[model samples]
Target: MKPHLTLPIAIATALALAACSAAEPPAPAEPPVATETPATPMPADPMPATPANPSVGGAAMDAGKDIVTNASAAPNLSTLVAAVKAADLVATLQGAGPFTVFAPTDDAFAKLPAGTVDGLLKPEMKADLAGLLTYHVVAGNVDAAALTQQIEVGGGSATLTTVQGAILTAMSDGAGGITLTDGKGGTAKVTTADVRQSNGVVHVIDSVLMPK
Candidate 1:
């Protein structure tokens, strides 16, 4: 009876050991294999466009201000500024519209028939003065590239309609210089090109544009 009891006890112990082995916690799943994902590459920087000609009239053109405000900075444009004020065009130019102005220097105004500017400043001649001023402006901002492309498209000449409803012609005046022909067949050579303003662009012209 004692030997039979010993054998049964040993079998029970062996069964308990098998159950404990089966219940082990799966060795923690091998810690998920530690996979390392490669990092994404960063994009390259963009190349900046070439800058246009330097600002005109010994001052850098301010892109943050409107055409009128920027034009006021040019020492050579004082006469043009006075004419603009007298003609009441400051508000119009300061508005949201993007107007292209062929700005004339003081020397350009001097080229006008003597007393022409004085006469235009008169109260009764305001309309005429405004017309003349507007003639120098186009409805949209016309940059140097656009002007040159238009000239090429028009077989070496481009006709731009001014804000005053007059036609002005643009043509290459030899060696990459541009000349604008007004309604009266007078020409204004662009001494400086691409004077960027906030609301528009300005090309400093050697002569003021006149409308018929």
Candidate 2:
């Protein structure tokens, strides 16, 4: 009986050992699956800049505005503006004309004989004032670069026909400046150049240009 009992106990022990060996050893703790961190993103490129408009007569000259509007805003161009209004040329200048205007400042008008401006502003002198004012204007948009090119092509001097039916001579003043000779043989120097307007361009002069 004792031998039989010993054989049964041995069999039971062997069965328990086989069951333990077959069981998975807790999957080896899964090796702690390494969590990869996400990568950072990069930035984009910048844009190009635009050019700014130039200033005039202690005021900002807007390239979006017309010649009459711009001239009316300038502190030094008040006399010229008044003359334009008196001469009934506001409509003409404000029209769609890519004109080139040789604008004279208040100081330039002051250089004339005393009471000359006042006399011209009178109602009777309207036609005369209009003629004088129109003498400073050309048909198309002639900027400084175009004028310079014309000067170079015309043997150092260029003849510009004004809207007033008169010719004005443009030449280099031998000192890196432009000098304009009117129909009356008087000379005016360009103090400010390339003052761009929506309907035209302006070159401010030290003296007023006159017609015959």
Q: Pick the candidate with the highest TM-score.
A: 1
lDDT of each model, Cα atoms only? 0.89, 0.91
Which parts of model 2 are misplaced by more than 4 Å?
1-51
Give the lDDT of residue 158 in candidate 1. 98
Report the C-alpha lDDT of model 2 over 14-116, residue by residue, as the tens digit: 9999999888475655568788889776666666664455676888888888989999989999999999999999998888898999999999999999999
lDDT of 1 by residue, 62-168 (tens): 87789898888889999999989999999999988798999999999999899988998888888899999999999888899999999999999999998898899
- What C-alpha lDDT, on a 0 to 100 scale, does residue 183 get in candidate 2? 84
**TM-score against native, each model:** 0.79, 0.76
What is the C-alpha local distance difference test score of candidate 1?
0.89
Structure candidate 2, residue pairs in collision: none
